[model samples]
Target: MKPLDPRLLRYARGTRVYLAATVALGVVLAALIVAQATLLAHGITAVFLDGADVRTLTPTLIALATVVAGRAAVAWAQETVAVRSSAAVKSELRGRLLAHLVAVGPARGGDTGAVTTLITRGLDALDAYFARYLPQLVLAALVPAVVLARLLPADLTATMTIALTLPLIPIFMALVGLHTEAANHRQFRLLSRLSHHFLDVVAGLTTLKVFGRAGAQAATIRRISAEQRRLTMRTLRVAFLSSLVLELLATLSVALVAVGIGLRLVSGHLDLTTALLVLILAPEAYLPLRQVGAHYHASAEGLAAAEEAFAILETPVPARGAAPAPAGTIVFDDVVVRYRDRDALHLSATVEPGEIMALTGPSGCGKSTALDVLLGFVTPDHGRVTVGGVDLASVDPAAWRSTIAWVPQRPYLFAGSIRDNIALGRTPMHLPEPPTAFAHCFTGTVPDAPRPDVAAAARLAGAAGFIAGLPDGYDAALGDDGAGLSAGQRQRIALARAFLRDAPIVLLDEPTANLDTETAADVMAAIRRLAHGRTVIIAAHRPELIALADRIVDLAPQPVGAR
Candidate 1:
């Protein structure tokens, strides 16, 4: 997918080493097969037909047993290594896929269902690839070539016949399974849809319950599950038929070798030992090829997953090189950002540092979009966003965001401890103060009064009372999206997070949206406290919030729908 996802090839690369060993080992293995076959042929000729004594047969029997034991030992080691490699690959690849998903952020929510399917279920299908398909692929390449070389000396006609039929096995596999790739893709798509639907239903379960529609929704879910089952069955049917066809083809080819040997014996052109050897070695030669075809079905799905992971992993990361932050005034010149295909006039404001500028607009206006553009989360299609007198395009987005603290209308709480999630923006764990490290993640440099700063930020946002009231205070656990807290509480916590940031510039988006009137007043006061001696911008619709602004620029409607 990205030429090769290193993780997918990790198992493949290990297998390649094992593969080389297997080839050298398989030569020893094929030699053992030939020796065992030869011993059996010689034993049959001497003991049964020639009426020879145990003296002639006993040594050959020991040699045959020895070869079988050797092959058994090699096979066991090979299989064990293959399984370990598969486990390693699965673990590493799964981690990489998850990391890729995390890196894509909320932008991927639209494709979350499909992406999750690839990571969880699709990647799981790769077990057979590394554990089986890879080995079979290796053996398929090696076994036949060695077997052919050995057989050519003893029974030229029979060996050539078997050689000709080998390609037929794969050809037949493809002919019967021509539509398999397409069907597998469709099945995966359905899997993504199914996962998306399940998540949607679970999230909206409370809503459905309140509407008294849970029963009808359950019926709909059942129907979707039934359809998914039907598609799964269809996919398996194709796999089964393909495997059956390969098996039958192999069996037929081996049967033909027997027939050819019989004719040779009747015509007095071949010996009994040679004929027996040919028959024994024929099926084992096709063994690897047959396994490869069977394992391909599972590998197809893994390949698909690898392809999806690549899309995210290869997505451009914000460049941090060249034309570093310039030493001049930051500027946003006639900047405009619109949601795709929507005509909404976003903010048009101009200000310098040591200023408290408030953004006030009706609901569904572009206040948030304006901040997003300045923060470089979204780019303006029509206007230039400049920082330090350099066009944003000329500088690194990552570096630009480093100089700002943005608290959004909604704050994401990761699935971990509050402290751990906050530490994400920090340099690393080894830093002197953990809370200070978190404070620096939003702003490049740590703020003064690490512990008290966190407490003060929380206090200003009216979160201090609840946080201090908790059993563990600052160490209290927060659920995903701060679930244990109410909507107003979450907003306050976000406000605290931003306040602790202490960047040169603070972009606040609807900071008081979900708060009660009393909490809003406390938050407004907190904002005033934090804004002193720093640049602060706010998006507000409430009168209490609007009153805090020094100047307000009202956006008038344009012919294009919204302005």
Candidate 2:
């Protein structure tokens, strides 16, 4: 990726504002540089050559100090704006990336660990890019020209020398940047792999210990970590080498201009003030370029990550329709879903309003695919789905989804109070017993405030009994994935959430997968209550659960070309 990739502007919001601000700041900084250098030169010459006393140089000293203060203020403002702009860009990119991931769905096969690392650490790397590199890039473009223009009036020979030697720094930078960019990209990829492997192993650590392969996995992790370390060192080495080259080139350029100014001063052809001014401005001419090269290495990783983010943003999302989904029946007319190199499902089914339908199939027989299609996550390769004679393709996805509630095989429970998990932080209208009321009634201790709708829904799902028995009642905090709750308890909570949703359609996937006989029975009772007055579709195999369905559709795996 280029040091300042154009794609960032396309993917991250507020980039143009940052660029414009950077340019304005760079111009201000350049003007300050010229003023400060001029003032300092005149002050020094007045004191040393013109034999001016301290009192005579007081005004020059004050003006130089003021110009110095102005330069400092400009630098401070530049940094403050850069920090804010970086934050805004990162926020915008993260939001867009997550939304796109949802739109594309799981069929896109994104790695969870990779995506997490990208959004968190990878995007953070952009701080260096925005806060340091981008501003330097703007300064490099503006400062050198401004400084050189000022030098031309002081000493033409020195200005000409600066112009001739300045090109070498960028020529060297371009060559070093090519190598640095490649090294940074490789390092980023390795970092992503390391993150993914670590997360995968940690998530399955229990399984590894059970199979007595934990020791082997530890060795694998060590090996991967060592490899990542080695690559990191190599990348750092290249970055250091690039920085060294740019520093050397800049120093040489400044030295050349200084030598020309000194020779002219010795020949009496140049005044002391002009020589001093040219000498001061000579280094300033190359300072921005050197800083740009230095910051480029720091920002290389972020640039690589930004490139990946843009690739995802550029992917086409499934087109959503404009019409609202109608009420009545959802018809899958000879629908077919094909995964690359394989056909996952083919079906002709109709789910009528206010009726329950069960989808039964063996593993890998596309039971889930059918559900995904219905949920608008996947599009059929052939035929179409319609609701009340209106094609699903003609119905807006968000509008269509608003009418349905879904419970997956494994319900995800975020770490929060029971009420927050159930309501997912949204305020519901229904009122029931408050958490304090439930606590007083069941545990004899008044606790936190309650979510009435959460309690009412839990009662309907038969989860209120367990929730009420807890020390904090509905106010209890649970760990990730409901660590303190049994599988049946979690299922009941999911059912309660579905009940609270009170949508026109409900879809359940293996609602009783990990439940015991008694718990399953309780969940089934809840399901029956939830199914009442709603169109329900269940992907289930349990006889009792299947029996509740008004109709059962069994799916079988079909060949690639099967009709």
Number of the predicted model whose TM-score against the real structure is largest = 2
Q: After superposing candidate 2 on the true structure, give the runs of residues whose Cα lies further than 4 Å from its correct spot.
A: 1-13, 98-109, 196-222, 267-271, 353-356, 424-453, 514-525, 532-534, 541-554, 559-562
Candidate 1 structure quality by residue, lDDT tens digits, 468-498: 7788877777765565776667666666666
C-alpha RMSD in Å of predicted model 1 compared with the true structure? 5.2
> Global lDDT for candidate 2?
0.83
Best by lDDT: 2
C-alpha RMSD of each candidate structure in angstroms = 5.2, 5.7
Worst 10 residues of 2 by lDDT: 429-438
Clashing pairs in 2: none
True-vs-predicted CA distance for residue 284, candidate 1, Å: 1.5
Clash-forming residue pairs, model 1: 425-441
